[model samples]
Target: MTRKPALAVVGATGAVGAVMLQILSQHADVWGDIRLVASRRSAGRKLAVRGEETEVVALSEDALTGVDVALFLVPDEVSARWAPIAAAKGAVVVDNSAAFRMDPEVPLVVPEVNPHAVRVRPRGIVASPHCTTLAMLPAVGALHAEFGLRELVVSSYQAVSGAGRDAVALLRAQLSVVAGTELGAGPGDVRRAVGDDLGPFAAPLALNVVPWSGTLEEGGWSSEELGLRAETRKILGLPGLRVAATFVRVPVITTHSLAVHARFENEVTVERAHEILATSPGVVLYDDPEAGDFPTPADVVGTDPTWVGRVRRAPDDECALDLFVCGDNLRKGAALNSAQIAEAVALEIGPGAGDRRGLGSGQGPGSA
Candidate 1:
């Protein structure tokens, strides 16, 4: 019998890493040896995966030696520095950072949206889109497939967790400060309560919503917003597609939500859009606002599918539709997508494909 592929779960102790472990435990036992690797401080710790206590090895060349696949859930800098090393070592790297998203050599993959693109990785790396972009792409891709998507205008209500553990902790701390008092009604009230320590966010995120979420970019666009635009166009295979996005920080802990306005070359209707979303893989259509049945962050957290609701044609335009979408940032938006890509690689490796080391030599994605 062919042996199963060996897998390395890099960044195995982070927030998204925790979810990736849970997903591995919950999903199929397709892997042979599941190696866990993290920072030096987290190296000796044990994490539960596939119902076993796996001790994390410190990130090093030896840790990734002989691994068939490496799933990177680390920061952009860490991924930037390490992912290429892993790729050089012959492990197909599925990176969840912004390190290689725009690199022409690396394919930015959203399994539900563009699974076929996974096959052409010149860099032996697959980049997952930003959490906000992932939160809405399944539905958008589905609609685009049917309607020839021409443009997109989206506003994202992002959870603090998307910013990472420190941001989550900061939000919790601020919440504790403003939980009991009726403080938000007055001007400067929330500002005085959650004074400094906003973590990665620009302002207080407990009783407030900050319109900014990423570093400022050219033309006043946040990096996150520009990422949304770039990732959308690439995933949809639509170069020169017009996309405008505004990312905001909300108090939610896990799920990210988006309000999308999509314009299509062909006329669209609410019924057709609903039907498309309902049938699309990795998407759930939940549009029944009269009965209070619409996608919300609370209802969608910890889930894998993108929940879409509030579907309607734009009142003034026959070819435009509006939608509200919600998805778990840590799940589909990060860990889950990376895991899915790894699974795809596993399928290519199949059984008995021994010694895949140095396998990513400009080979086709399925070249095991």
Candidate 2:
């Protein structure tokens, strides 16, 4: 009998990790003996997966024993230190962190857009793009395929959950302080009310949107804005694609939204673009403003597909289109992408791996 791959879900107690557990239960049964791994602090906690409660073991060399695939939903620093170790131990690591996305050898993949890239992982690690980039790329990639992408102008309205639990709590607390009040109507009113507890944001997130969401970069760009530009290029295989982006933190809970102005090589129209998106894999076209229908974060928070709406050809340019896309940051943006990559690796290794146990026998996808 062909043996199903054994899997490890690292950071099993994290926000994205929790969502990953839900995804595992809902996805096709392709794994055997699923192991949950977390920090020493989160160890011993029982988490449910595949209709069974599994105790999380502390992340260590032994925790990854005989694992065929490791889905890393941890922080950048943590992933940096551990993903290679997991990879070296024969597990193909699908990391959901900034640690490896830009690595020349690690494939930054969006399954719907760049599934082929997953097979060339020289480092035995696959990278998921930033949640902000994941929010819009499925639709964007569809449009680019038909029209030939030229440039992108994007502005992201990112939800707080992408910043982690503390940011979510900060936004909720600030909402309570400013609710039913004229706090945003006056200057410094909302700021004073929210006080100094920004919690990963540069400005108050109660009634206002902060123009920044990541560490500052050269030329005054934020890490997120630059990440959007870089990851989009890598995933789309467009190294020189012109992209300008601004990332903003909004008072939402779960989904990330993007307003994209995409310039293509050939002429584009709303009718054709609609047809393309409506049929694209992992994408939903919900563009009907007259009927009060358009993709919004509130409506897209829990959904798995990228919801694209308000799609229009630029009024002044036949080669450009404007779109608003929303995606649950924790799902497709993070956990779902990692899960998909791991699945791809499983399929690549096939069901006849025998005692090799996935990529650990010195036969990683990169050698494929």
Report the lDDT of model 1 for residue 116: 90
TM-score of each: 0.96, 0.97
List the candidate 1 regions with Cα displacement exceeding 4 Å: 355-368
Instruction: For candidate 2, list the clashing residue pairs, or say none.
Output: 90-360
Writing each residue's lDDT as its tens digit, candidate 1 over 1-368 gives: 45688899999999999999999999987888899999999989988899999899999999977888899999999999999888887778999999999998889999998999888887788888999899999999999999999999999899999888988888889989998899899998898888977788777887889999878899999999999999998999898999999888899999999999999999999988988998999999998979989988988999999999999999999999999999999999999999999998888766543433334334323333
lDDT of 1 at 270: 91
Judged by whole-model lDDT over C-alpha atoms, candidate 2 comes out at 0.90
lDDT of 2 at 28: 93
Per-residue lDDT tens digits for candidate 2, residues 127-241, read: 9999999999999999999999999999989899988887788899999999888779998999998898788888898888889988889999988899988999998989999
TM-score, predicted candidate 1 vs. hidden true structure:
0.96
Clashing pairs in 1: 2-351, 2-352, 3-352, 90-358
Per-candidate Cα RMSD to the true structure, in Å, reads 2.0, 1.6
C-alpha lDDT of residue 358 in model 1: 39
| C-alpha lDDT of all candidate models, in order | 0.89, 0.90
